[model samples]
Target chain A: MNVTDLCGLAPPEPLERILVWLDAAEPDEVATFRLPHVPYPLFDHLTLRPCCWDTTEQADGTALVRIVRQ
Target chain B: MINPEFSLPLAVPLRFFRTAPLWLLLAGVLFLLEPSTVLSSRHAPEALALTHALMLGFAGNIMLGALLQVAAVVAGVRAARAGLAGLMVWLGLQLGVALLVAGLWFMQPLLLQGAALSLSLTLLPLAGWLFVRLCRSPACDPTSTGLAFSVLALVTTVLLGSALVLVLTRGAALPFAALLRQHVLWGSAGWAGMLLTSVAVTVVPMFLVTPPWPAKLVRLLVPGTFLLLLAMLCWPVLMPLLVLPAAALVLPLWRLLQQSKRCVDPARWLWAWGGLNLLLVFGLSPWQAEDGILDAVVLGGQFLLGGLLPIFTAMLGKIIPFLLWLDYRRQRPLAGPLRHMGQLFPERWLKYLGWLALVAGLCWPWGGVAATAAGGVLLVYALLLLGMLRQACCKAVAALVV
Candidate 1:
């Protein structure tokens, strides 16, 4: 999980919006996010996946995620 | 620290993306001037040349360029020296396509042999390089594996294509029909189609605001496609099956787009058009058609509408705009205006291009004056697309400099 992964491809898909969410998210806290695209490695710089991280598919094909930070 | 090579300069893949439409332009002009030559039959030299121009010159260019971008962005790995590799392959393909098209048109054995040699040098090496880079990617995902398989397909296409060139030049003593079918199948459904389906999993979900592909489905699509291709060698009747997986994955995408609450888009239109054509053309065994002009039309129409044009249309309307804005943002980290794709280019023009591509795809099969008109229209479509892309580039640059 690296930030470089997030910076490589795709634009205009709420990437920046997700980053804003990450900025406001409580540090060392667990949260759930349903994003249109993977915000993992990009959010990994915040240590979002250092603990319990699970990704599953929604009926419409987006990712439903729960990250439990230590 | 990010590896310095993690991202190829924006210019690297964009060069191929920009250059692809030129091939379509050349194909349309060639078909227009030599309508009779192209309309005669599927076996006609002119028709063969035209197909090569659209297939290798146009489709191949986009596939290679996109992979370089996808590898770095999606898979978290980069092709070392992508710019140099892209340049060599670009020059080689241009020369090879020119020589091959001329050879097919003039029925010149020496030129055909030379074209084969040139393509071999370019495509084979590039495929190897790409395959290695994809394998080294940090992300172990379906897209990466599918890309590796697609490169293998490219290698296979080159080998068979070169052999066919030798056979055409009378340099080889072998049967032609079986080998030709194999070649077309591997190149179209295997290399191009596989790559398209693989990319669709991410591109459709991400850009279109549609549901992501079911993980189970995405994981098996590429490897299953390859196995089907391998089996086709033993059972020729399975040729139609080669297109089935791609059609299956994309058909649902169209339905998803229809049900999507996202705003209307020309890119969506192009993708839907492609999905429809894929079903119409490859839904059945094309070998069942009797030999004649109609058969030629069906085959060519299927690949053009079902495979190439629709794919490129989506790419142009959707991917290019995002790439442009991404580059612009890199320049203005703080005060840069974040513009949506519709702001960069009018959606009306793209929607028109979508219809134009659809009309041209449908019109290609009706030979004679209609075919000529179709070619002419396609040429216009290609030119307009190139113009719009260039404008996008210029605007992005202006924003950066200003």
Candidate 2:
């Protein structure tokens, strides 16, 4: 699935869940499913895929997470 | 909702250390000097210098630093360069203020204009940038909204400030006096007024353990105040038009007090009393007597800055201790948590000081002796606060060491 499919997921919390689904997909298929908008640095660092979510998503999300880069 | 304890961020502590004392000192000096020349002469240099001292030196620095720290914490945006930005702003502001004051005292209009313009220009972008970042933050609350309004006020402050400079330096063929009046109105009512109101809404309720006030007051009053101020700017001829908006803006605080839970937080009580008294003093002056305007202005300044601001300082006297205790307790949960808030500062002393200052201000209208007594009482209060701050710092240091 492309980033657009992920965008359609609507909320940030569910998007994390969807990332798991994508990760569980065949490696080749998952490799082909690029998150177009996410920076490569962030995409590579994430266990699944990273998405650019807005403030409304942040306010509505269940958990707060901070991504630390090494 | 997140634990209110953890809601306040680390930057706040740093800001408190840096900015709070400076404000107190400026407030003290203004109280002592009683610059009759500045007040009566309408000398641009004297008036502008005093204005900048209060606005930029005392109120602006504290508010800017505190707002940045609070906004970052509340908005959950780790300011990428807050430390450096803060330092730069502080240094530039201080240097600019020193030069501006010197220029004004010496009657060097060029230097005054240059310093004022430089200070405003340097700080404006930082304030604007900070506000934009805050707007993008995930957590937007009443405090944040109040801060956002303050930022807008800062912008207007800069624009009018620069205009004042141009008029002073080049003898610009514009209505300089008209512009100066507008600048004062916007700076005093828009910038200082809004920030103080916002702080009151968030802090008074928190300290009082009061039920949450409706956010509508903040939402309506902040923007409404700005819009009205903007309207006044457009029609300078309608100077009297300001009275309606100012009263309307102050109405929410009256309502908030009616609904406040802890009627006994001596500091908050004094603040409510002083604020209402000043409002009435100013509100009624238009009808009763023209000569009372100066007295009203002085009394209003005392109430707002002297009375209301100190209430917050006293509140901080409690808050800082509690925060220090919490910070320590987090490290060692069983170390016999630091003394209760009551033990940290002398509440009775604060109450006495508050009463003395209020009484003196009220009586000053009758006799100069009362005004002198008020100044002395205020000086004592300032020294007391300094002593408490020093003690708190020592305790905090001990906690860190242990």
Candidate 2 ranges with C-alpha deviation above 4 Å: A1-70, B1-39, B42-48, B237-263, B281-290, B293-308, B311-315, B322-336, B356-360, B363-369
- Tens-place lDDT per residue, model 2, A7-37, is 2221121223334444454433432222211
Q: Write the per-residue lDDT of candidate 1 for residues B1-402, one digit (tens) a residue.
A: 223235456787788888888988998898888888677667888889988888877877787778777766666555567677668878898899989989998989999998999999988887887788778755566777888898899888889888898788875886688888889888878898788877777777666666556678788989999899889878987776755686667767777788544557677778877877766656654654554433755566556855568767877677677767665654554335555666576678788788888777777666567667778887898899889889888877877776
Best by TM-score: 1
What is candidate 2's lDDT per residue for B8-37, written digit by digit as tens?
Answer: 333444454445455445544654576454
Candidate 1 residue runs with Cα over 4 Å from true position:
A1-10, A18-70, B1-5, B291-294
Instruction: Itemize residue pairs with steric clashes in candidate 1.
Output: A60-B211, A61-B212
Candidate 1 CAPRI-style tier: incorrect
TM for every model, in the order presented, reads 0.86, 0.72
* Candidate number of the best lDDT: 1
